[model samples]
Target: MSSPCFPPLEPPALSPETPVPQGPVAPPLPLPSDLSSLAFPLPASSPQAPIPPPPPLPPPPPVGGLAPPHVFGLEKSQLLKEALEKAGPVPGSRDDVKRLLTLQKDRFRSDLWWILFCADLPSLLQEGPQCGLVALWMAGTLLAPPSGIPLERLVQMAMDRGYTAQGEMFSVADMGKLAQEALGCQAELLCGGLGGPNRERVLRHLVSGHPLLIPYDEDFNHEPCKKKGYKAHWAVSTGVLLGTQAVPSLGYSEDPELPGLFHPVPGTPRRPPPPPEEGSPGAVYLLCKQGKSWHYQLWDYDQVQDSNLQLTEFSPERAADGRAYVVPEGGVRAGLCGQALLLSPKDSGR
Candidate 1:
């Protein structure tokens, strides 16, 4: 049998930098006379160096002269926890209170998207007064859940839920939604006339550790609105001062000029309403209603300065204590337009 014929072998290609090894050369194989001038392939070049990455971008400048910008995230949860833990048992410590209260402002300053996330509200007063918002925000902080919802998240949720009063005025309904979002429960709303039958019930609620949102009548001028008549405003009742069972009545003066109304000391100048007397029904710690500060340009309900409805045995009359009398006004006839909100969980069954 003929031996197996072998194909001609070519030497392995080497890079130009690699030195060729000295060795005995083999005779070149004979090529067909017809295949003359055969060309050889060139070596491949090294891969081009990798392209460099672009330089990082510079950070954006801070706005409104606020603190450095912060990325919103779960880190806020730690902050909430720290604030609550700092409060300890009593939540009213000045520092703790201030810290919790300022969280909203601090977050607002730190977050670049806060203004936009807040829906760019033109003015808190322009939509609905912030008395209710402040009251609600305060309550939310005090009643913060064990899970620790941040004030920033609360405002964001409020904005998303359309509870921040875009295009319309903020109302009790909006407050309910806000409370529901923050507390994970819908709040209870109380409605009645100022100095109406519900006044006692409101006082009872405040006594039972339930904060009430009552209408505040600003009487800094010392004028009794019942005598002139005015609207009942909104305020949050943090505490209640109980008066004696019997509130002293203003006695009729002999002056013919003022037959119906009782007259105080002659020539007494107009003064701010005095604190409730022993027998007075009671006074509530009305927050966000009467403060004259200009924090957010929100007009407090106290601007109304009076309640048209009055509590009296006979006709509407002022009390003898010389203080402007206001009550949890509620009734179909004349009371606050909004409802008193109670931070309670909503009914899951519904």
Candidate 2:
């Protein structure tokens, strides 16, 4: 039996003479050797977060930092070739392979980290409530650079091209295809099993140099993330910062007076979170990098008080499975849900 597929988009009946509106082309983002020369620059008026004195250098690298490439069960070349095969060629055009290159100067920059704060695209649903489509649109801008496609045009094209299926939302399963389509060229898109979180797979890809387009279960709270909704949300992982201040260790309580503790619910009067002892561990602060400095900030998505920035104590406890979980200030807990999307070049073979 044939697998069920999303219905193909029906093209509007346009006469041969009908003029097709073209999308605005954006210039490619710059990749420079100097960290200060990032392609996307911070706005001039934006405020910088305060940075505390650097803590002692990070402890020696942890064990099992990453798994061998061999565990992927395929030779590097074979892997890319297979992914390319599954990805197939562009639906209706002939173009060379699309390779998504990074701007990183060194293969290994111990202190360097990557982020997408500078490339922030307001998640406006031009066609519908599809963040996945927004992700593809933004990914295309980063991967293809100089791709000045406007948000409305990108959304319109993606919808018209049938990228959105299944309840008017882009399927996380087909994020790669959307990415390939948006780039208008053959590119490398990778993902972990839809089953659960694969930190190793994600870390391996990050270390390999490509920024990861990770999808978070809005409900999962194990990691410190800024975006929040009751449904799946997508964010890009540009890079990882090596060493930053760790979360202070403090037991959880429902009292509003507790440091690093506040109800994140907007508009509603503040209420204390559940007892930390009963909740799962999560991040209290997200260490964000701007230019050459690392600044600590509360989760941008949740509405915790501005004064609640200082974390009095760092309380991270080990879970039964040997992994350490940090309970957030507000007591929200989430574990790793192993789903992710990787974007790379056709030649990368990762």
Candidate 3:
């Protein structure tokens, strides 16, 4: 007899073609890194709860931050050998890797930070519902000079201008306004709701050397992100993943308890993620930062926000023995907000 394996990623979750829901009765979220009044379940006291200010960013440093190199380097590689080495077992084709590489840049230099995600400015991580703010900070600075504004101040600014409501900054229009105010950039709303007509338009925008601040459900299931009370989250999209097999996949080991059998690594991809597509279509993933952790992520954008959602117990949180982004059974399909905003240098007009 064989031990049951971690189940497959739902079909709905798998086919997000390149775009990117629901409820919960879970206890209120903890105030991790200034999350109070910044995310779901709006803070108890009103008149805009006071947010904690983040620590100051260090002066510019000498070398890059991440050693393992969490992001694509300035030099190019079609096979993604480095990322594949660490973020591998799943490999991307040369074309897909090349296409994805076009999105990364040397955003941070000095002591302040290195790459966004893996080696990041610690101060940016200590704010409330600031996932997008970090993404925005990184996006604004990409291929340009770093802005001195602290993420805490930006959050406060957003708060003061009423860009935030119901514990989240849900409007792309509002985010664009804040981007102009904080980073001196112009943000264009590319698409609203995943699978909208402009889904592929995002690709054109990115290739021009700009990034989109997109919203996503924190759920691994990736669909039907809308719930009754709140719109979930906003993260920055560095680029799109075109079915790169270099992404980590389900790692299996023979069950120690049941000899000759196997069990999947708790949180790795289930069903080996529909392999990199030959043309990079049905498998385009967005390289993003959801602001939940220290590194950027490759998430499926080809998903939609309609009712065809599927729920699963197979959340990334399961990897930590339920110590991570866990949600109740059948509730894992929520959190995929389907909108995006493209931020460009206000001066460049790209």
Relative to the true structure, how large is the alpha-carbon lDDT of every model?
Answer: 0.35, 0.34, 0.45
Estimate the TM-score for candidate 1.
0.36
Local accuracy of candidate 2 as per-residue lDDT tens digits, 193-301: 2212333343444434454554443324423333322233444543322211222123212223222221123233432222112111221112111111111112222
**Least well predicted 10-residue stretch by lDDT in candidate 1:** 114-123
The number of residue pairs in model 1 that clash at the backbone is: 10
lDDT of 3 by residue, 40-72 (tens): 755547556566578999987535333332222
List RMSD in Å for every model shown: 30.9, 26.5, 26.4
Q: Tens digits of per-residue lDDT for model 1 on 142-209?
A: 35554455445555565566544321112444555556656655355554433343444444444333
Model 2: worst 10 consecutive residues (lDDT sum): 92-101
> What is candidate 3's CA lDDT for residue 282?
42
**What would the TM-scores of all predictions be?**
0.36, 0.34, 0.45
Highest TM-score scorer:
3
The full ranking of all candidates by lDDT, starting with the best, is 3, 1, 2
lDDT winner, 1 or 3: 3
Residue pairs whose backbone atoms clash in candidate 1: 186-346, 192-329, 192-330, 192-331, 193-329, 193-330, 193-331, 194-329, 194-330, 215-233
TM-score of 3: 0.45
Cand. 2 TM to true fold: 0.34
